[model samples]
Structures are given as C-alpha cells and as structure tokens.
Target chain A: MTGADRPGEFELIARVFAPLAGEGAFGLVDDAAVLTPPPGEDLVLTKDAVVAGVHFFPDDPWDAVAQKALRVNLSDLAAKGARPLGYLLGLGLPDGWRTEDAEALGRGLALDQDAYGLRLLGGDTVRSPERLMLSVTVFGAVPAGRMARRGGATPRDVIVVTGTIGDAALGLKLRLDAGLSGRLGLADADRDHLLDRYLLPRPRSAVAGAVLAHAGGAMDVSDGLVGDLAKMAAASGVAIRLDASRVPLSDAARAAIAADPALLRTALGGGDDYEIAVALDEDDCDAFVDACRDAGVAATPIGRAEAGRGVTVVGTDGAVMDLGAGSYAHF
Target chain B: MTGADRPGEFELIARVFAPLAGEGAFGLVDDAAVLTPPPGEDLVLTKDAVVAGVHFFPDDPWDAVAQKALRVNLSDLAAKGARPLGYLLGLGLPDGWRTEDAEALGRGLALDQDAYGLRLLGGDTVRSPERLMLSVTVFGAVPAGRMARRGGATPRDVIVVTGTIGDAALGLKLRLDAGLSGRLGLADADRDHLLDRYLLPRPRSAVAGAVLAHAGGAMDVSDGLVGDLAKMAAASGVAIRLDASRVPLSDAARAAIAADPALLRTALGGGDDYEIAVALDEDDCDAFVDACRDAGVAATPIGRAEAGRGVTVVGTDGAVMDLGAGSYAHF
Candidate 1:
C-alpha cells in the first residue's frame, strides 16, 4: 500500500504504542493519561528532544535512535534523584518513513521501557516534512521535598560523578573521523566501547535513592563535564575546582587523550556523556560511594565546591588548565 | 551578529522562558521541575506536537505557532476534565532562526500560560536541520479517580458539544483556498473569524469542572466531530447518532455553508475545531448546559448514544450522510 493507504495514525498507534501503555494510559485511547503519585510523593518532570542528523547520525540504527531519545530524558530524572514513572513521546516522522522502521522504533522504546520499569503514558505522532524528530517528556516520582536541586550545593561540598565521563565525546570524534579510532592506537574492543557509550547511555537510575539521600545538588553531565559543571557551580552560587586527572575516563578515552594531549579538551568539553554529576557534604562522601557501590554503580570523587564563582580545572602538574568554551551550547 | 553569534541557548532561555517559570521550576536551572499535586488528586498527562509545514505554514507567525502547539495539548487536558497545572515545551529551532522570533514564541507561550493559569516547568531546546517543530507535554490535576475516561459513555447518553464547530474546517479551506472565502460571500470580519479559528483554538478549559461532574464521556473535537465521535463510540461500546442539523455552527460557518450547500460534509468531517464533545445522561443534560452557560460557554445537545457500534450522522433532510472519510488522519 502507498504511505497514505497504509495504517492511519490511530491504527499505527494501536499496533505499535498500545501495548507499551501502562494502566494509567487508558490503552492510549484517552485524551490524557492519569497518574496517581504515591502518597506524599512529588512528580518530577523533564523534557528532552533528539533530532536526526543533530542528536544522532541520520544513518544510525532506528532502535538506537529511539533508545537514545528516551535514555537522555531518563538521565535527567536520574540526576534529579527520581525513579522513572512513565514517559510521553512526541514523534515527528518524515513522509517516506517505513512501517518497518516505525516498528523498530517501537521495539526499541519497548526494550528500554522494560529495562527501566517504566511505561508509555501518552503521546502524539505527526508527519514532518523533513527530518525525523523525537521528543520525550519523562515523569518520575520522588519523596516529597527530597529531590536533588542544582542550587543546593554549598562550599566545601564534595563533587562526585557516576560512571566514566568523556567516552561519548571521544565516540563522537570517532564517528565524525572514522580513521581517528585507528590513529589513537586503540584496541577494537576499546573503540567499540566508546562507540557504544555514544550510541546508548546507561542512566544511573539505580543509585537515585542514594543520590537523593546524600546529594546536595546534582545534574546530568550531558553537554560535556566542564560546561555542565560550570552551570552547576553558577546555579549553586559556588565555585568548583576540578582535578582534571580525576575526571573519570574510560580506557578508550584515556588512550585517545594519551595519543594526543590536545584531545583532552574535547573530552572535557564535548557533549552527550549522560553521566550524573552531584555535590554533597564532604563527610557523606564515603557513605554515598558505598551506597552507589552496593547499587552496582561506580561513584568517583572528582572535585570540590568552594566559596567562590566559576570553575577551575587543575592539571596533573597542579597548574590551572585553560579549557576553551567549557560546555556545549546548542545555540 | 550572525545566528551562530546570537545569544546562546541558556541566555535565550533566561531572557525569555525563565520569566515564565513558576514556583518549583527552579528558574529553569534545575534538571527537572518538581510538582506536588494537591492531596487526593491525580496528575493528568498529555503531549502534542506541531511541525512547521505539517501543522502550520512555514511562514506562519512564530507566536501563533507557539500558541497552537500549547493550545492543542491544553485541549486534551480540557477533554479529560482536568485543570491545567503546568507544561513542558520541547522546541526544535532551525539553524537560521532569528532571536526576535524566539522571543516572540516565548511571549506567545507566556500569554497563554497566564491566560490558562499554568506555568513553564522544564524543557529542552535543540537545533533542527530543516523546519521548526514544537512539542508540548501538559500536566493537569483532577480529583482522585474522577478523571473523565473515553469508556464512560452508556446507552441513552445524550451527546452534547461545547461552543461552535466547523468554523475551523472551513477556516482551513479558506486558508488553502483564499478565493473560496469571497466565493462563500463572507464579510471581511467573518473571513477573519474563520481564519482565526483555524489559526488558534480556544480550548474549553472553562467548562472542565462541569464536564467532570456531569459528563459520562468526553473528548475534544480535534479530528472532526464525526470521526472523534466515532472514536468515543468505539471506546464506550455504544453507537452515536448525530443530528447534522443540530451540530452547532458559528455565524461565519453558517454564512459559508449558506453560500455552498456541499460544505456540510466538510463542516462535519474536517478537523482542528478543538471544541469539547461530551456524552451525558438525558436527565442531566439541562443542568450540564446551565453549568456551561454559567461558565460563559454555549452547550448544544446534538444527539444520543445507543446500543451499537460506530456513528451515523443524520442530515438536515433526515437522510444518513455518507462522509467519505469519517475523520482527518495523518498517515
């Protein structure tokens, strides 16, 4: 059948998205989904969008594209110390989009929904004239008044991060410069690791309870750590001093940076590393680390908040490092 | 300055969207907005998207585009018998978008936020390679277990619709066929009214409380009253018989139809009216109408639900009308 004669919007939704809907979704037929928060809980709301060719290569796998769209929003919830409840997806498909690709996208979303213990709540699908764009509005729940806020960090707070940073940035470099992976003298496995990190983010949701219990301020490190940290510091009305060596890097990133020290700037300032950066009292560091460890997440102390402004990154030689354009801005 | 040198994303958000942020929004700095639903309430969630060429003309006013995006989602909440709490926006701007246009979009959103008693919570902005697109996910609140569902209608329920319909469909015709307006012998004001109805939808949020209290089932008439009624009928397992002569029409629409007798099918089947269509018991119809009247809304009883499936529209001639397509569908 021609595109117009194919399954219409409602039939497509029923065949693809209906099974993903949870109890509150009214099987995707109702105008709106009903969500009853647990007693005394607060709803955490966040929205993120990914467009083909910008957020991901247009040629990327449809499943990975769908996963990346949902995972990025889930990363925000993880930073805010909230557990995933459900998400609403806004999908804009190009005119030539195939039913098989749509099904693949649904399968990708379904996989992540099962993995994250969340369900589709409600959404809208429309036809676009050009590129495919996906927007996800994630709903999460945390105990009342207990969500981590970016403005809560104070002087002397320990700055910590979950998982490695800069892998995605390096992966992006490899994606844009295919030969760079070999130039960095990296193993095949290391190259694959960086590429996977760029393609799919493992949001640190498992440690959200611990982060809520201990973090004073937090945010997901999406737009490169240096810029994101500067934002967090500005929001908290404090200064942050990062030991550049302490910013966790995967083996692939380390190999690339070692091969060309100039690559460190990209590692520090590239975007799409969906790791959680948080600040807490120095005294609570050990407990938070232990908690994250128990939750199967690796937590590392990267720096400290100080009673000043902006961000300062120190090199291994104890000299301040000048990193140009500390973060990614999509202006 | 060129587009690349224009205000960065954060600066743009601060100058425009930050002012629209309400309490618990953390001034748009926090990763997620925290929403505390009033005790014994259920949170309602809905999302809608509009693309540049698909939903609006590429050259449409940025403010009107923004308003259309938010208003469409608000229409969903109104149908579900919920009060607007807040909304999250995901905006994808083309590379050459002007700063002034961005500000205009923000102003448009702010105007509606105030008009609707909602606020901006959180959102993400990204760069699109081609056309501008916007997605809005709205949150509303209703008393626990009181949300209007699509499956609540029963046999013998009276079918009612709030405000006028068909103006938008004709407005769309006027939009696409500029010559058709004069052919329909519409006055300048009537022409403008039809165009405005097509450009901006006034969601029936004013009657939500009354709808929740009195309606058995309801939905906003977005995809034409005929098709949307069929959907409600299928969901509620009841047949809907709509008297075409009783379907409310604005003066502008009436003028157009008077000039063109064949416009009736377009009036009943064209989309984008955004009025609420509801079902209630015949015994409660008068009280519901009075309640809507008190709220400054006009309610019209058009038909009744019966034991069957699908929808049958009776023409002014007392004959069944055959609308080739029951509703507008985006495939």
Candidate 2:
C-alpha cells in the first residue's frame, strides 16, 4: 500500500518502536521513561532531531539513518560525561514510506540502544508528506560533580581532544560533490575513511568522565574544532590557541592533504567528529591523559586556553596562521 | 525559497525552535523537564501524537490543529487526576510549510501553554515532506492517593461521565461531507455548537480529580464514549451496560439527532470530546454527584460495570440492545 494508506499513529508506533525492549529496567509500555539515576549520580538529559535532507540524504539507507539519529544524540550525552540510560523517539514518516523501511529503521535503533546499554522507552509516530524525521531524547547520568559544561575553562587550562578531526567533513564533501572525488584522485582507502566518518560517528563517552572529573571545561566537537572550540572559549570567558602541527589526523587524511593542502582546510573546518574537547590546568594534563589511557581511549593535547577573546592557531615557528573558515553555517 | 534550498539542521532548529521563549521556571533551555511534584502529590506523564490526515484534516486550521494536539495529551493527564503542569513538544513540519504558518502554530502552542499553566519545556523540530505532525509529552501532578487508573474498577461499579458527548464526531462528518449539512438542516445555534466542539475541546482535568478522589476507576473519553468505556471495562476485567436513555445531549444535539436519528450512532461513537468516563462504587454515586455539583461540572450516571465481557446498551424501554460497534479507530 502507498504511504497515504499506511496504518494510523498507534498502529504504526506499535509496529515500529514497541518491539525494541529495554534491558534491566521498567517496562516500555509505562507512561514515562521510568529510569532512576543511580545514587550519587546526576541525571543528564539531551534532545536532538534529524530532519530529512538537512540531517541526512533523503535516500540515505534506513539503517544508517536510524543509527545516525541515535548516535548523534548519544554524542551529546557523551560530551556531558554521562553514561547512557534510555531514550524516547518521536518519528514522523511520510505517507509513502513502506512498513519494511520503517521496520528496518527501527531495527537499527534497537541495535544501537542495545549496544549502548540504553533501553528504548516510548515514542510517538505520525504520518507526514514526503520526508522522514526522527527526534531522539536521551537520558544519561554522571557522578555528581563530574558533569562537563563548556563554561568552566580557565586561562591556564590545557586543551585536549579525543580522536582525529575533519574526516567527517571530507566524507560529506565526497558525498555531496563528485568533482571533489575526481580532484582528490582518491584511492579506496581514502574514500572508505571519509565514508565511515560521515556515516558512523563514535561518541567518546568513556574518557568524558575522566576529562570532566579532572578538567575545567569540555564540549563535543559537533561544529568543527575551530568553531566549536570558539564557542567553548566564549562560554568559558577565555581565549584558546591551537598548535596547528599537533592537531591529529588519520594517515589517510594526511595523504589526502599531501595530494592537496586545501584538504587540511576541510579537516580543520569540517565537523561531525563526535570528539570531546577539554580544557584542564597544565599540571592536570598529564593525569588526564593517563586517565584516558587507563580507559583505553585516546587523548591528544592540541591547544591551551588563555585569557583573551577568539581563537588563534599558531605554527611551529609561533607565527599565527589562518585555518580556513570552519563548519557549515545555515544563515 | 524552496525547501530544497533550505539550510542545514542547526539553521532550521535555530530559526524554528530555539529562539521561541517559554515560560517554565527552568524553561526550554534545560537538560530535562524539571518537575517538582507537590509534596504529597503524584506525578503523571502522558505522550500522544497528532498526525496530519490521520488525526485531522490536512487543511485543518492551524490553531485548531494546535488545540487538538494539546488537548488530547492533556486528556490523558486529566484521566490520571493530574493538574496540567507543562509539556514538551516535538514538531515535524513538511518541507513546503511556510515560515509564517510555523510561527502561527507556535503562537497557538504558546497560548495554550499559558492557558493551561504548562510551560513548553523543550522540543525538536525537523523537516518532513507531506503532513505536519505534533508529538506532545505532558506532565502534571495529583494528590498522592487520588490518581486514577482503568484497572481499578471493580464489577458492579457505577459508570459516570462528565459533559455532553458526540458533537465532535458530527462536526467532523459535516466538515467532510457537506451533503450531511442539508440533511440535518441545522440552525446557526446547532451548527455553532457542533463546530465549537470540533474547534475547541476542554480537558476535564478538574472533573477527573473529583472522580479519581471518589470513583473506582477512570479514563478520558477520546475514542468515543462507547468505545473508550469498553476499553475501561476491558482493562478493569469487567463488562459494561449503558442506559442509552440517560446519555446526555445538548438541545442542539437533540434537534440534530431528531432530524437524522442516525446521528445518535455518531454521537455514541464519535471521539475527541475530552470528557471523563468514570466508575464509582454504587454507595458513592450520590456523594460523587454532589461533589461534581459543587465543582460546577455536570456528572451523569450512564452505565454500570458488570461481570460479563462485552457491553450491553439498555434502551428507553429497558430492552437490552447491542452497541456491537462503536469507537473512532485510527487504523
């Protein structure tokens, strides 16, 4: 049947979301998400939505769409130094969407929820016109005093980040413009790295607690390192300076940049890395790095927070260099 | 600009949802809905979604759409004997939706949130293709011992309902098929009464509290009186028998039904009236009626919860008739 003939809200919800049960918790049929934060832990809740076209390709695979929707929200919780608890989903599907597609998307969500140790609580479903939208509200918890915010950095704080940057930006560029693919003369290795970064981003939650426990301020790099760090600096009332040479890049990214230095510009400005950016005092940086190593997560020192406004990236010779404008802007 | 040319996710959210200020104590900028259930009170939360074409006409007025979306959710909270506190809304607008239309819808939501003393906590906005979808999660609080559940009704409980029923169904029928307009030949008063029920529905939150405080079990009449009452009986593991003659109707309803007796079926099976259907002990019925009288809300004894499995409607002559089919089914 066509989407217009699809089942109504209740039936569609029962078919799509009801089967993804939670582990070690209250029933999903309950009126609200019945999770109770563990003692000495504070609840951390964040919500985000992925719109058709804006957040994903209209023709993006249903499984990827579902996973991305859940993952993006999880990344927010991770940035806050919280462990996953459960989530509520609100899905708006067009009349033309197939039941199989919806089911596939649900399975993807179920997979991530199970993988992350989060239960699928409850959600609402409705019919729309053409595009599909998913709104996810995640609940997590962090030990008291361990939750991270972007406003806690001090002038002497050392800046650190998890994982490499800019691969996702390259991935998006490749996906959107075929001309870029031809220009880079990309091999399968470079193409795969970019694709993986764009499609599946890993949220760095394990080291988040350690960073928040020891560091002064932190945020996730959603909108490119430069733009997001700029936000963190503004929120923390400090200036930040990045050591351009220390910024980590995957071997594939380095190779791509070698082919064309402009690729470095993309890595610096392109976002969706889901990496945590933290600021800690110089004396605490070593301990924080040790904590990350103990957690089996990578941590790299890339910059330092200083007393000023705006962010500046300095070369090895201490000369200020311009990182091309970072991240996508709507307006 | 065409929706295809619209900016990315961050831009869309900033334009549509982020800047809209709400009146909650913590407002829309928080991590989670901060609800302080009054001391000695119980918290109740319910979520529901209204899909275009499924729950309403695609062309329904924006304010009416907002009203239906909010009232339906509030109806659920009211049935739990909770006073409305606030709601979190997740809205999905079609790609072609006008910005002004969205703002008008937002104003409608703001108006209701203010009227009900519920703040719009936080919500997500996404772009969809065909229809506009609204998913609302409402929270409220009731006296600890007075919250109602459908499973609490025992056999032999007296069934009661507040307010007149079926006007919404007739209104919808008239709106969809103008041929029915001439058949009923409704006067301006009759037309206005039916239309009012469609445009604006009041959740019986106050009446619900009185019932929950005294009645054995309760639910709001959403899927028509006959269908919803049957659901209550099913949940309570009891049967129901309605006194058809005692079903209250407005004078306009009576006249319209007289012109087309078939209208009674619509009245009996029509949904979206937002009335409270309650089961109370036989001994408590008089006291309950007195309480409703003091509260200035009408309370009518309509049926009894019996020991059998299905519903039996007793006619004016005391003959048992089968209301074999009644209710508004979305699917």
Candidate 3:
C-alpha cells in the first residue's frame, strides 16, 4: 500500500497483485496481453463474480476468498472439459481498505495460482464504497469440437458425480450458524472440514479429460444438485432418476445429517459445491468411473437419464420427496 | 425484471443481456462459451472497470455509462491494433436497482455491439451492497507478433497523436460544476461538446491498422496528454520534447481555453481522452498520418523523442513548463 491511508492504483498492482501477477513486471498495469491459442484447440471462457456477504463472509480470509473466486470460474472450465490456461481478475476493494487486506488478497491469489496451475494474465482493480467484490474471468482450452455441453444427455446415459457433494452445503449452514458445531456434536476436524469446504471450493479439474472422453453431458454443481439436475433434464429433453442414498457425502456432512435429519434437504439443495455431475453413455460409465479414480477423484453413480422430462430424487427411505426451489439464483 | 422487486439472475441474462448476447438463446446462463481464434491471429485481452461517481456520474444515462465502460477497453485494443471479437461483462448492482437500468445497460451494449462488431460471450451480474460497478473484459484478435506495445520508442521516432485532446477534461469540469458553464460563458452547443466528450469516449479503432503498420510504439491517452506522454517516454526509456501549442484541441475546448486562459492547463493535463499517441520513425510519420487520414481520423505530429529521459513540454511562448502531476492516478 502507499504511505497514505490506502494504496493508489499503481501500488495496488505492485503489492496486492504482484505475487499472483508474476515475476519481473506486473502485467496487471500493462495495457493488454496477447496469446495464441494452442493449435486445434478452442478456448473456453467463463466468468464468475463474488461479493462480500453475498457469496462469502465479508470477514473471510482474503486468501481463501481469492481461491474461492478462482475456483468458481475454474469449476466452469472443468465442467466444459477444458484444460486450465490462465485468468484475469477484477477486484473491487472496500472503503478504508488497508495494506494488510490487500496483501492477504494477493497472497491468496498467489497460493491458488500455484495449486491450480494457472497464472494471472491481466486485470483491473477498482474501489468499492461498501463491500469487496471479485470478478474472475478464466480462460482454458479444449480440443476442437470436444467441449462437454449441457444438452447431450439421452436415455442411454448414466449419471455420476465427482467427489462428495453435500459437505460444502452443510459447511455453509454451519458457518451461518455459529452454534451449529455444538448442535451437531462435531469434532474439531469435522468443523474445520465443513467451514473450509464452504470457504474454498476444490474444482474438479483433475477429471476434466475423463469427462471430455466419456460424458455425454456435464455441469458443475454450483447451485443445488436437484435444481441443477432439473436444468440438465430440461436442456437435454430427458428425465433423471436419482437415488438420494447414492449421493455421496463427506463424513462431516454425514455427522451433521445424523444430528438433524431435516438438514438433509439443506445438503441436497444448498449451493457452492464445485463438483462435476456428468451423464455418460451406459457403456462408458465404468470407464469414466475408472478414469476419475485414476485421477484421484471419487466418482459415484447416482442416477440415470430416461426418455421424459424433469428430475426425480428417491430418498433413502425409498419414497419420492419434493426438493423445493433448490437452485441458487443470483439476482 | 423477474416479476419481483428485482430481476433474478436468469431473468437478468434473458432480458438485460439478450440484446448484446444474441437472439436464439441467452448464453448468459450457460456454463461456458468456447471460441477458436481466426487462423494466423493471436488473441489480445484487456479489462477495465468503471464505477459510479468515479468514472462517470452515477446518474449518467445507462447507455452512455455502458458505452464508456466498453470504449475504455476498446481503446486498449485499438492501441494494440487488435480487432474487436467479444467481451465478458461483470456487473455489480446496488441494492434496489431497477429494471429500466438493467435494460438500458443492455441496449447500450447492443448498440455498441453493432457499431464495434463484437458480441457478448458471457457474463455475470451480482448484487452490490452500495454502488453500481461494471467490469468489462474485452477480447480481440491481432495479427501474429503485431500487437503494439508501450515500449519501443527511440531518438529516431517522431510522436503523433490521433484526434483532438483536452475536450473531455474541460467537459468533466463543466459537468462537475454547472456554474462553470456560465462563468466560462459557454454556448449551449459548446457546453454540450465538452460534456459529451466527457461522458463518452470515441476510441481510435479506425486508425488501428495505420498504427500497427507504421508506429514504433503506442499508447492510448486516457490519463491527461502530458502525463500519459510522460508514461510513454518513461516506458520507452526516451525523452520526449512536446510542443504544447501543437496539442490539438476541439472547437469547444479551444473556446473554453480562449475564455479562461488558465484552463489551458486543464486541457493539457486532463484525463479520459481516449486518443492514441504513437512514436513513429520520422521517415514513416507522414505515411502513418496519411493512412490515418484515409481512415477518417486526424493525425497530428505533436512531439519528438530525444536521447534522454522523462518528458518535456514546450509552451506556446517557447519556454519549458512544468505540467504538474498530470497523470490520472486511481487510488
């Protein structure tokens, strides 16, 4: 930060963005960046924006907040079966923004850039009078004509999800309710797991190749699983039959659900789970599962597509239930 | 709007972004978009943000706000000689934003889409607790290894600036102080000229080809002419000797300066002049000027690079003058 109460635009680039912007010069202050797309690959572009309190806790660590911003966009890329390339950040700092807050943000971005194998290309930083906001535009590449889409699932497809789904949803619940840890009699590790998952998403980039190879259609579960599945059904003109018992959950989520059975709905309907849910040809289902396993991701078969419309979820009790308005709408 | 107090995100994409996103279906709600660059062209990317009361008047027409947001990035692209291709928008809306504002924003984008030949790839609209802000990430295509840069000038180069300068700076002054119009005795037409230039930027996209063909180095003058010229000199590691009297001024700016001779400083050191300044080989300067003229842009030789550092401004009186800290710095 500048010696003044807050950093100027140039100082903002040199410090808060330097760690992630790269070695030598900060491209953050440059006019523009130029790159050639890899041969025979189409560039995949997606943007996701997060605001203080709306998407994450305003007091959340800037590093994790930076990671959350990156991962949300990365999740979109992975769902499209694209390989990570780079990203541009648009950050809006809150009033009286301090040097430490800015440094922490840059540190968070630097850490995630290493972990996710992408670098900051270029970006813009601005001032916000009230809350902090981050807008991340991630660019990736997929082989020509091979990017997964949301409209290809058919009656011959089997549905599967990568990684546990409900951990983040339950984590969000616990974060919003401070007494939740005690209400559920959770261990410290479980509490941390839930809170961490809610704060930072683990995008399924590892299985992007497998999904590209075998999935007929795919989407990242950012909104509630049931609502997203319903969207998939509508887009593909098919019906999906999901077995709720087959839906994977982290141990922490299971603990929470065990304490309050009603929380199961929250697990199924809450947003921020950056897991890929894909529909594969029945014949390719085993191969896809194996590929994900090799990628060190847990893949569980959860549903099937049929020649009809809408999504159905049968509970552990073998009875159909209403999921309600589960999809997260950001308006 | 989504028939609620405000538009839901899906409805937002469907209505506000439809005109710019295209007709058939809104890609706004889709997972991601993929595009392959044209053969033999490298992608050029840049992002710039505008905020209410900061970049433009908070109550400025949404269309003008949208255009200003867009032109800032387009200016970057043109300075790099990149042809417009597409863009992703990240909008943060203040609490209680209305339907009209959203639609006007889209309409403005749509008008520019047709004028500038770029479509919306995708975007996100999120809620802001306070002010409305827009972050635009624009993408363009430039011929391989041909994107103009900020550094490459030498003692052998002559500096030329495109279009006129200082209109916007004076325009900004008129906007911020309604009484200034009367004090300057600005006619209605003259006042409108300054105010219009401040509210909107006419990016030098027309002469991009000319610049790429004959310029040694280039940068758009967004900050004041003197300050930006100083940056160009610093970046290229060359000293620039500018004849301040040669700096072109529009009719309105000239009229304002004629009324208040002291306002000449504001004209020379004002920001938001979205004009291109280039350093060209003395031998190639005329051809560059000719090419720009043929493309319907005015190009005037304003300065020359010398074997030294920093930037010098020679007044109409033929005396060296300090232009103050003329560059616009965003804190």
Candidate closest to the true structure, highest TM-score? 1
TM-score of chain A in every predicted structure: 0.98, 0.92, 0.96
**Per-residue alpha-carbon lDDT of candidate 3 for residues A112-228, written as tens digits (9 for 90 to 100):** 788878888888877776778899989889998788988878996899999998888888888888998997899999999988899999999999999899999999999989999
Name the docking class for model 1: high
Pairing residues by index, what is the TM-score of model 1?
Answer: 0.98
Q: Write the per-residue lDDT of candidate 1 for residues A1-331, one digit (tens) a residue.
A: 2475467788899999999999799999999998877997988999999998888988888889999999999999999999999999999987788888889999999999999989999899998757888999988999998989988889999999998988998898988998998888989998999999999988999989888999999999999899999999999999999999898888788888899898888888888888899999999999999999999999999999999999999987789999977788876
| Runs with alpha carbons beyond 4 Å of true place in candidate 1 | none
Candidate 3, chain A: TM-score against the reference: 0.96
* Candidate 2 displacement at residue A227 in angstroms: 3.5
lDDT of 2 by residue, B1-331 (tens): 3565554545555465555445432334232333345556655656677878878888877777887788888887777677887666777676577666766676777777767777766666655556677877676777764567766678889999888888888878877887776778888888878877877788776666587678788888888888888777777889999998899888878888889886887888888788888898999998888888787788899989989786777877799765655866543
Specify the highest-lDDT model's number: 1
- Isolated chain B TM-score per model: 0.98, 0.90, 0.96
Could you give the interface RMSD of candidate 1 in angstroms? Answer: 1.1
Compared with the true structure, the alpha-carbon lDDT of candidate 2 equals 0.74
The lDDT ranking, best first, is 1, 3, 2
Least accurate 10 contiguous residues by lDDT in model 3 chain B: B21-30
What would the TM-scores of all predictions be? 0.98, 0.84, 0.96
